[model samples]
Target: MRTLLDLVLPLECAGCGVPGEQWCTGCSRALYVPPVVVRPRVDPGVPCWALGTYSGPRRSGIIALKERGRRSVARPFGRALAEAVGHLRVAGEIDPPELGSLVLVCAPTRARAARARGGDPVLRCARIAAEQLAPETVLVPELLRMSTGVRDSVGLSAGQRQSNVAGRVEVVGVRRSRSDNGGARTGSCTVLLVDDVVTTGATLAESARVLKDFGVPLAGALVVAHA
Candidate 1:
């Protein structure tokens, strides 16, 4: 059953602007490849698990969601991200548990970016991943904004990316604590940083630095795509 507007108006594909398909068949085919689990220690201080390379339809999809205001598309993109990093293990993987413990901490986007995009796309994707992995994992939003800057990581080298965001993240707030209302304090918990894409991993590495300083156990990073 189609609505009057749906029938009267045309809908172009998010990826290729093709009519009828939400994502054009050609673009959908470009969204992914067999998932590649890359242990990228590119950020030195922080470890990361990246999925597919940034190119073709995958690149188009990410751009559509980020710059083109396709918030709804993040669901499928997030699903792809989760699948890419789901069974990951190792320092540069899905934040390997020290004694079998897993916690997910989504990276915080800048206020300007959030405002420009209408909402936080990375957080949206991370929330989807959390919902899909609920009950089996402990996912929480424990990271906070420590700086106000933006970096374009499209084609920069690893070292350039590292310098771009150095000393950019800081940890604030203690969750599960009674200090807010004066109740029993549970202290801080371990965290695994989550994001939508990783070019040089500057953001994730900075997050790890903040968590480590705050006494929270630092796990690796998780992402949907790598460029």
Candidate 2:
């Protein structure tokens, strides 16, 4: 019945005007066919990778996914990010364990933002990608908190960016009790931070700093796009 309804009440492609598919193949191909790798100095401690440049169709697709309620579009977007990270792996940029023991940690959104969106968008995307890349990767939601009254991260200069995120984000809900399975002594594990988009590396850098302080081995960062 639902399938029939979907066929009848056509949904235009979020990427293109093509009917049926949420995002047409052509547009999806254009989304992240060739992901970009950026190495700005601000992203210290943890290596950061953004899938696509924030321009042209990629920018439009991301805006639609974030602001226009095209939440279903996250699947393809996550795949693109995973692919980008995989590309880095092949290029010897990021090194996952031989057994591929890695955790996917998402940067937390403000309480109000989560309430407005009904859920954390980056977490949602991370889960989808983790599922698709399952067995090889594990999803860890061990980052974030309500606002620390930090200054708004927008329009800040590079130096100001460093100061703004300093000591603002904290490590809140990580379990330290050792399990039967021996991992890190603090129960802190290797983690790769995930986010939807990054303009300035301020937010990502801040999150990485907090995770490093928590004694979690900083692996890398994954995001859908860079601005």
Candidate 2, run of 10 with poorest lDDT: 1-10
Q: Candidate 2 — which pairs collide?
A: none
Candidate 1 regions exceeding 4 Å error are: 1-12, 16-18, 23-41, 89-101, 149-160, 175-190
Tens-place lDDT per residue, model 2, 1-227, is 12343355568776665776777787777655545666755765667777667765567666666666567777777777666656766787666546355578887566665667656767767777777666675555646764656665567887787687677777777665546333454254446788877777777788877766666666777777777
The positional error of residue 174 in candidate 1, measured at the CA in angstroms, is 2.7
Candidate lDDT scores, in order, read 0.62, 0.67
lDDT of 1 by residue, 47-103 (tens): 555556776556777787788777656766666655544555432444443444455
Q: What's the CA error at residue 49 for candidate 2, in Å?
A: 1.4
Highest lDDT: which candidate? 2
Screening candidate 1 with a backbone cut-off below 3 angstroms (N, C-alpha, C), the clashing residue pairs are none
